[model samples]
Target: MSREYKNVISQIFKYLAISLVFMVFGFFVGQRFIPQEYIYYANRIIAILGVLFVLLAIFSRKRIIPSRFSMNYVYLFTFIDGILMYPLFQYYLYDLGIGLFVSIVLGTAVLFGVLSMVSSRKSGGYYLGLGNILFAGLVGLLVLGLINIFFGGARFNLVISAISLLIFTGYILYDISLIKYSVENRFIKDKNDLSIHVLNLYLDFINILLNLLNIASYLDD
Candidate 1:
């Protein structure tokens, strides 16, 4: 592997490891320590803060803030994202049961590992057309999800979960492959570029994990 590739790989793994820690913390807080009302309200606040951090990262990159603020934006968003994983996993643990939750986590980890390895072996990003198709599917999935929230049935949700699972799996492959291409092609402008890459991979993994868990829970029901 090239030095830059190794650097990015290390950064990705580092954040991933931090992700596990926050998820465990979230699980613990939700299961044991947090009271019902606080659990309800805290998530709302955290959700808003998460959005702000994302915006901060966006604006920082656009140079709305000083150049020195760049890494801070990335760091804050990354940390917040890790904390966000906790509440998410906690909710899943409660709804899905510990056994199923463990199964899904293991399954997601294996799937992500395989995808990352496969992506690393490739030379360039897949065609832009694939990304367009995947994104279109994602937008459709969101519309369906919003509709399902109101008017859909169990079967509809199951279908949505299945489709989301597949979409994110494709996303994982696309993202990892893109990471390789960008690095090899000298597209990484700075550390912030790697930060954004890690965030993308992190989101992809989390989405796939939740989608699989949702599918599993529906099947169990």
Candidate 2:
């Protein structure tokens, strides 16, 4: 990769690592004060913010404009996503059955790794197409998840969540790698683009971790 790409990747990872640290901290802190239902709402709000950040990133890149809108939105979204997902996971921890949860988590991780490798091989319109696919998948999974919560079995919900988590994680890694490669190739002219990459990765990490937490909670139960 080129130096610019390296710089973007570096920033993305840096922000991701920082967000993880804060997530852990917030998880502990939230345990003390927040209720479970409210936490779920908070998670949804963060999800919305994440969606918005991604939109800004895409728009800024297309319009040849740059803004800190990406970074701030991602940072806030990741933090809140983590905070809210924690309680939900805790709530379901005992019911998920440990053996099954472990299997699911491992499977999801492997799937993410594979998808990342595949996405890395293509570019240009491929990235845009992939992004659209990802967005659609997320929406579809979200609907299924909500349905499972109200009308389906716990096992069904867990399964859907695990798949969703893996896809989102793949997106996070893919987006980070793209940004890095773009910067290195001089494809991204604006520095703000770097911020967009960072935000995308951060959100990806948040979603992945939250899904993992939920899986863990299910296993514990």
Candidate 3:
């Protein structure tokens, strides 16, 4: 890998590690410290704050807000992501047991590692052109998800989970490929850009894990 490519990857992973720490901390606090009576309310508040921060970061990117704080907004949004995921993870861990949970987590990690490696190759740009296609798949998944919420079935959920797994896994490749492309083309101009890359990876990892868990759960049912 070129030095710049390596540096960009290193910075992205460094920020990813920090985000994971906050994720774990948030999960721990949600599971162990928050009172049962307040858990619902806490999640609501966290979700709202997550949306607000995301908008703030977007606006900052558009120059509506000072760009200097955009990276901070990204980090803060990631911390909220963890907390927002707490209740869902708790439900799965409790309903399906730790064995399934651990297996899904390991599966996600392995898949992420493999895809990242593939995207780090010199020819990674092959995946770079997939951004628009993968995004369309993602949008389709969201529409299917909402439709299922009203006309839901275990089988429907399984199908969505299966499709979503493929899409998000594809995203891992695309995001990593973009990282390599960005470095080679000098597109990553600043720390804020780096933080956005990290956020994309973070979301990809989280979604993969969630979809894997959903698939396993549906299959078991």
Candidate 4:
């Protein structure tokens, strides 16, 4: 990799590590520092903000996030998303204890590492071509997730989470491939591009991590 490309990748890894720390810190805040009801609402608030931040970051070129905005907010939303995920992780921890949490994190780390390495290679075009299929699967998963929210069936949730895990695994591979392609083609022109791409990888990582934790926790419960 070129030095610039290597620097970009290193920045991505650095941001991801920092984001994970924020998540763990959020967990501590939720479990100890804050009241349960407050943390409950805080999670919702952060989730909404997370979406808005992502959208704003995407549309920054149009003056939504603004050119003057710092990259800190991009990372902040990542931290917020981590906070938003705290409850789900806590629930799983309750279900399966600390061991499962550790295993899930380890497994996700390994999977992400392998996928990122492979996807960063010059031969990563195959994952890039799956854009349409991946979108279709995500939409289907969204519909199924909504249905489960209303119906509350164990079977439906299991299936949904399983499918979600697969989708996010695909996402990780595809997203990393996109990063490699964008960097090589000189498509990542500004901080906006960097922030958005990092956010994409962060989303892929968290989805797989959360879903893996959920699935294993359910089985263990």
lDDT of all predictions, in order shown?
0.64, 0.57, 0.69, 0.64
Q: Considering summed lDDT, which 10 consecutive residues are worst modelled in model 2? A: 42-51
**Model 2 steric clash pairs:** 4-184, 5-180, 5-183, 5-184, 93-217, 93-221, 94-221, 95-221, 96-218
> CA shift at 221, candidate 2, in angstroms?
5.8
Tell me the tens digit of each residue's lDDT in model 3 across 1-221: 88888887888888887888888777876677555554344323422333343344334324565423466666677667666667767767765799989988888889898989987884647696776777667666666766665565667767876787787788788878877887778778778778767767777787778767767766676
Give me the displacement of residue 160 in model 3, in angstroms.
0.8
Candidate ranking (lDDT, best to worst): 3, 4, 1, 2
lDDT of residue 195 for candidate 1: 61
Name the top lDDT candidate: 3
lDDT of 4 by residue, 79-108 (tens): 665565566566666667798778888999
CA deviation > 4 Å runs, candidate 1? 1-3, 26-88, 127-129
Per-residue CA lDDT of candidate 1, range 1-221, in tens? 57788787777678666655665555554456444444444324333433343344334334564433244454455555545545555555677889988888899999999988877777677533467777777667766766665566667766876887787788777777777788789887676666666656666676677668667756777
lDDT of prediction 1? 0.64
Q: Which residue pairs show backbone clashes in model 3?
A: none
Put down candidate 2 lDDT per residue, 1-221, tens digits, no spaces.
34554555556567766766666666666777776566445334434433444454345434444444555555565566556556554543434555664565466556545655565555523454466667666666656655654565547656765876766765754574566456545676654555666655555554565567555655665
Among all windows of ten consecutive residues in candidate 3, which has the lowest summed lDDT? Answer: 42-51
